[model samples]
Target: MGKEFIEIFEKWADTYDSSLTKDIEYKEVFRGYDQILDSVANKAFGEVVEFGPGTGNLTVKLLELGLSVTGIEPSPAMRKLADEKLKGKAVVKDGDFLSFTVEKKPDVFVSTYAFHHLTDKEKAEAITLYSNLLSSSGKIVFADTMFRSEEEYEKAKAAASQSGFHNLAADLAREYYSTIPKLKGMLEENGFTATFTRLNEFVWIMEGIKLQ
Candidate 1:
């Protein structure tokens, strides 16, 4: 879904952590960053498959929690950085949302800040695929930018433009950021009970527990 932005991620790899610290526009987006990572790691259990682990931030947390993590990162540069940071504690390989291989059945599928690469249809497809792959009581925990409604989405874009966050505004317009209702429907259709919690102004933690 977001593979189109691979080049950008590759370029951003080295500066990604710096940007999180220095970028005022993203301050709200990543507010309570550690908390967000901890929340996701806490919800996960057993063998975990983490998609789009940009720089292994959440991967570290998962490992610290004694959860085995298999990270799927599409960007080579990002993978290298993650590997360096991880120090062989976890394996981060080349893969994306729709395609990947794992050694074991994952108890939880987790992602952070990267799922917005998929359009709504693709998001539904991914959810369906995960539902089919996971066993009963498996979980999906993702933290990403999602709005509650189309109107809110529009307002966010407008506000960004008004605030002179041109790049952010453009990103809001260009990305496949989704609405909560749409995501909830997709999870339910795929046989999961869905719930969402707002982690910040721009991010939400979505949890879907597969039915028994």
Candidate 2:
């Protein structure tokens, strides 16, 4: 499944950014992301490590804030695009979030529209890994598809399928959508204080601060 996930992104790399930008729903999501990420920038500290930085859209914004960013992207093609977009402003690493290692603990760890690629268990494990990689005051900020509950997720999946959004239906079937309440519980269980900001019914930004 992991290899397949990587392959999917690799295949979509060239068209990924364009597809998101051209889709009205995704365009609105990106706009909301801009605002959410801007708020993240205000709270960031020394250095930031971004997971799956697709084509450097949010990476550019973090760079503009004068923050040093290290981006981990699994797809070579996508990494290449991000490298070109970042233009030496940030370091692009060829790896996935779950296995990547950092010599120094980052002050902030962030991801946008990326975590949904993982399954629920993987998401929990990733959060645990992130907690271990942060200092007491460090934070983790994420912007992605966040559902209110399992019921809401099911309803959305049904709606998408009925509307001919097969890809979305597939994602739902694969358990790629995160439920906000579940996520917050996981974060808190792992010793982080969590907060959520909803952008819409399906998208949200979350911040978790390591407890002292």
Considering summed lDDT, which 10 consecutive residues are worst modelled in model 2? 24-33
User: Model 2, range 1-212, lDDT digits (tens) per residue?
Assistant: 14458877878888887776576534544565557667766667678998988888888888888888888888888889999988888888877768786666798998878888887798899889888888778899988888888898889889878877776678667757878889999899999999998875577878999998
Output the lDDT of residue 181, model 1: 98
Q: Which stretches of candidate 2 lie over 4 Å from their true place?
A: 24-31
**Residue pairs in clash, model 1:** none
lDDT per residue, candidate 1, 123-196, as tens digits? 99999999989867999999999999999999999999999888789989988999999999999999999999
Best by lDDT: 1
Best prediction by TM-score:
1
lDDT, candidate 1, equals 0.93
